[model samples]
Target: MRLKLAFLMSAVLAAGCGWSGADATTESGGGTIEYWLWDSGQQPGYQKCADSFAKQNPGLNVHISQYGWDVYWSKLTAGFIADTAPDVFTDHLAKFAQFVDLGVLRPLDELAPTADINDGDYQEGLAELWKGQDGKRYGSPKDWDTIAMFYNPGALRAAGFSPDDLSDLSWNPRDGGTFEKMIAHLTVDKNGVRGDEPGFDKNNVSQYGLGSDGAGGGGWGQTQWSAFAGSAGWQVTDRNPWGTRFNLDQPAFQDTLTWYFGLARKGYMPSFAEIGGNNPVGPDKQIQSGLAAIALDGSWKISTFQNLTDTSGQKLKVGIAPTPIGPSGKRASMFNGLADSVTSLSKQPDNAAKWVKFMSGEECQNIIGESGIVFPARPSGTEKAIAFNKDKRQLDVTPFTDQVKDKTTFLFPVTTNAADITALLQPRMDAVYIGESPVSSLTTVNDQLNDLFKVAQ
Candidate 1:
């Protein structure tokens, strides 16, 4: 895992500028540390964290930047190559392994210990994910997430179903089971015909049964088809963390995706063409505008969907449901988490490490939890987040945690060559989703990926 990306890092990294250091200060031998993250929704909570960290360590300052997911990676890669990356930045499991292979991450082992951080401080197994094959740690756990189905209670009732009906929805690749039935029933045509009704036109849909945030969630599909596929007993890789082989070509996986994308064909889902304008409409907007009945999304989105309001500023009524049970006879959610990492290029590695440490601490994590933005890393923080959402915000978030409690959550696949893997898979998956290519074509793509992995760095 350490050197797997040696073959592709240069090509993937941008060709411009090098190590532009963060703004430095001479105050009592302290300096400013720049932190970058991709989620705008979590910015306010993290900003408070930054403020608190600075107050605790006088003379040191923290600067924060928020970028969209796509821009965040591109900018991080550019910074890495140009030597101008932020001092401390949020890291994803998918990308961190590649960063480890490229030797651009400062191992957290020694630094983590100094701050009294250990794997026990975070959700089970999250801290272990940042370790490379060489046993060097690169990330300190922050917050965790799992996928769930988000729905509009009003739409479900109008469709002649109640929120409880979603509690036990079952699915299968052959026919989509009760889950697809619910989606079809929830869909409404322009002329007021439901999708399950006769003469329900596939075209001219007034309300799609499902909404999406992207074309296909790239290769990971954490919020797209992951839950469905996983619950159907499809594993993304042979194992987690160090697995080199992908299961994209597996029959069950292919069949699952074929049915998932086929929903677009049935006009029950948002087609790429429908959401492909300059500004793509996300699930939240679709649900808020009464255009989509439900969407599969990450727990991180609880507040986003729950806080959604209409044009008149009235809060939209949204409900949460677990992933539908599948042929595996269980529900599944991709267990993903965010972490903070200090860059190998940082001008203030110590301060940056300290900031990363502080972010994972009880106070900072609790602040994040109380904000109702996300579930923080610590157990206490997770409890606080649940209470905040349930008691204060009037939202029960157990569906997200229930996956973990039931042991139906799978870890995000972690391996090197992540950027290359996505680069290879995204376009082909998009083609499949848009009906340009058969789902079976992924078999060849999987073979090609295996050849890349065979390099053994």
Candidate 2:
């Protein structure tokens, strides 16, 4: 999910043309700081914090900007190249190494002491994720996410299974274990036949057992197949935070990919033609329309899924489940965190740092947590977020938070050439998903990826 880029160049061009427009400035204090984020859902919460921040600091002002995920990254990249990047912006782990290498990010270590920002105040390992290979901090932790299964309880019951039956589902590469069995039982055809039945029609299926956002796994499957691959004892790289060797060609990874894609061939999952064709559907829509029984997604989508309504305007009751245990005798998830980074070319670095510090502070995090949008990076804020979801949204988020408390999550792959690596391997991965190529085809792509890694070094 991190590696997927769906930017529209036309929109980027339009934004670039208006870079010098009035939308770029708003006076506060004695100067203004430009801040950018991609998530529109979190805008209101941060806007409230920004207004409060400006009130307290009479001499400084912060102008917040929101954009779609793809447009946000594209504009940020164009701004960096033009030496007109935002004063401060939210950063992702997938792009962290590249931004650090480009020297577009200011080291937060120097600003932390002056701003009274303590790295220890944040969640464990989160602050560390923002540190560069040179041992300098580039960003401040904002929030974190983990992968989990989202299912409709009514659909499960229709399939003759209860919500309790979903607990502790196990998987394997060879036969898919109990996980595949569950999926097959849940899949139904237009003629009222289940996938597990002998007369079921693969082509005329009315509902899929499982659904994905797109064709499924990409270079980094944070919300896709990473759970399976990680639990099978596979790692994207030999080490993280600066690993040189990639292990996508390993047998464990290949075996997992084979089994994952086989679901498409068996009609338990959407086929590539259905997923990638015109009028393509996403996991959320599929579940809301009763075309899919289950979907694997990130914790950040909890609010969106909970608020979805079907054709008759009935609120869809979504349930959460942890990933199934794999061959390694455990379940796994990608532990990824997002942070805010100041630009190296900012005209007001001091003001920018102040804003970043405040945004990442406990006060603003508490506001964000109370919004029930995501799990804030601060432990206290995280507690408030869990409580908000339970009390207000009535959703159980333990399936996601439990991975962190249980220490069953792995860090997302962190490498300097992540973009290039994703660019090179994505097509091959697409082929695997479409059944045009076998999982072993990744060996050739792996070699290409290692070459790119060498060049990055």
Candidate 3:
């Protein structure tokens, strides 16, 4: 889920206090190179990698710093504007195209020969996503992710549905199928009336059956509605990576969205307005607060949900399930991954490339896998991640990993004009989610989105 990260600002103020970057000395071969990332949860793991690298290469320091997602991107954009960006930082499939266009990221192939890296060392189709239309590698593969449904076991039992019932849940745009029925049964209002029960008031709803990390998932629903759209067999572009045309207005996609957003009106899901503005309550918090019984979320939040604490700080047990079956007769998830790119602004390009290579290597990636926060791109590291989470953390990440093995995962749309795509679609999609605009309005936006690719040509 490329656009599907949880917007938890719990570390915002602390993370944004200062930016530990842009100070790499213009020395020959040995100097400190700054690295930055958005996820505070993954900082410790990367910090250890930085320490290992620094220890291996004396006099060449790697300063790893983290910031909130909003501030991370803002600071990154501002740094790019000022030509003072970090030497090496985490990169996403959605944003790298823009950086490649701006010529701010140094191509890995152009780096010093001493910093040797191999594409074959990573997972299939991962390192390939970091390549531009110019056919130059801009990033080294780090980790990958997918989407799944996480629910409160207590809530599922209360609704008279066993954990096994979720396995065969079927969905369609027409009547929502058994998935909708389960959502209805799980939803309860102020009077403790289930959504399926008579006299249930949607207005006085206290608990929703479904929740997401965000409202409008931009052009890619990801955690919001992507599981349904993807399972319904909808794709964002005609062809990814370098697509010239888009399928944002396809009937299959339109129908999927229509039913997806309709859940809010039925009080089975929270409306965009009900959730906190700008800083929304993520599915993890929703489960913790008793506002939602089930939530479709990305695999990146595996650690948080698997080890959750209630508002009163008591342990809350949560289980995950694969996305329900759709008209496509299969489950689906957006396959996404992250990488680290050395900035063109770096004075220590060789050292920066070395750092990036090391991070992508088995040693560093294995260290990251052991953190149990994400699945690394390297198969060896990925296996380590699966084992550590299941054995140590007691996390059942099979549903997430199964999507990859079962071939039920689709790539996150990788193309240029990603920011522009989100700008044009967010407000309109938010309107659709809130019932302020018809889903048909996106047909027009979709046309406009296609125009962006046309204009590029």
Candidate 4:
């Protein structure tokens, strides 16, 4: 399933120097292993872990570098083509299959045994998720995330609603059920009229009911519409961990997309014009600015949302809510994890493996967990993360953790042509988001996606 590296220098150069930060270059006559990560929020914690690793293994320095998500992937791909990929870098499940297929990832089974890295230490199915289609492990589980509703308590209170009102929201593809009603109730117009009211103006709405990181277009909508789709009994593919056939054309999926986009048309959500514009504001910023009352985001963003402050310098009190139940009578989320992988191009394979091992091990995971950044992949670390959020951050992460414990989660789609599929679907999805196309328009796009899957095979 491997494809040759199609290195486009123009694209790589267009990515620019945004990936450059914190001098992690190896010094002459010294052993310095370069590591890269996307989450700047976890940088200080991982830096602490690296310092600890250096102290324990004298003369070996772990230099960490970070970049924004999009830039990180572009540079990492460019590095792979140039044979200058990092010794170790954090990897995502969505991207790992493609990396493994391209032979860029180093197998980790032998190294894990030597490093005493127990696969059992990771959460259920996490270790297996790092395995390639050939049944070889390519990464070590680092941390996991699930989606939940992040709400601004101030906005909810201003609407004369309690936080408890968000607990049992439900949805249906037909009318959107209680979920749509709740969103309408929470939305407000410029004239201080709620969206559910008769005279409410959709044209001059002052606040939206919900928001998320991305607008509902492109390949996947894990944070945007996937929860609703999953709860409505829609699956991205027939199977995962190597699903060859995409199920984008299914009725349930089309129905879910229809309802999701209908919210924007109803002025319950922001339009693509608002979200994808130049100088577009993010969902977190929307909630912080009182423009959005709720946001469906991942657990990794908890710290960011909890620390949001208004223009008056007052901390915004955020509450967590589980995703609404759909017609299938259950809530759902994408159970995804991040892992650290060694690059096959590395000259120091053993060193890279050691670093990956240490990074995914209890020592480093504990530090990451206690920082309240993300729930670490290991069970013990997850416990620490829960406790840290509850006792220190005073935020209940149960809305996220409960999905894992209750088995109400689905795996992120794993396909070798994820990037290609995304490129093909994004414009079409954007069309749907802007009300220029109907949900049924995706049937044609789905055919194109399935054709790509065939080519991938």
Q: Is candidate 2 or candidate 3 better by lDDT?
A: 3
Candidate 1, pairs of clashing residues: 17-82, 18-82, 19-82, 19-83
RMSD of 1: 8.7
lDDT of 3 by residue, 1-457 (tens): 4334334453565568785554543232358888999988899999999999989998888888788877888899888777667899999888999889988989999888323567788777888888899988998999999999999988999989998998889899999999999999999999999999999999999989988556555638888888898898888888877887778678999898889888888899888877875578888989888899999888899988977987778899899899999999999999999999988988888889999888899899999999998999999999999999889977778899999889899898998998998898888887788788888888899899889978877
Strongest candidate by lDDT = 3
Whole-model alpha-carbon lDDT for candidate 4: 0.85
Which pairs clash in the backbone of model 2?
Answer: 29-59, 29-60, 30-59
Candidate 4: stretches off by over 4 Å: 1-29, 112-117
Q: What TM-score does model 4 achieve against the real structure?
A: 0.92
List ranges where model 2 is wrong by over 4 Å: 1-30, 112-117, 215-219, 277-280
> What TM-scores do the predictions have?
0.91, 0.92, 0.92, 0.92
Q: All models: lDDT? A: 0.86, 0.85, 0.86, 0.85
lDDT of 1: 0.86
Query: Compared with the true structure, what per-residue lDDT tens digits does model 1 show for residues 166-283?
Result: 9999999898899999999999999999998999998899999988665553648888899988998988889888887889889889889889998999989988778773256877
Model 4: lowest-lDDT 10 consecutive positions: 21-30
98 Cα displacement, candidate 1 (Å): 1.4
Model 4 CA lDDT for position 179? 82
- Model 4: clashing residue pairs? none
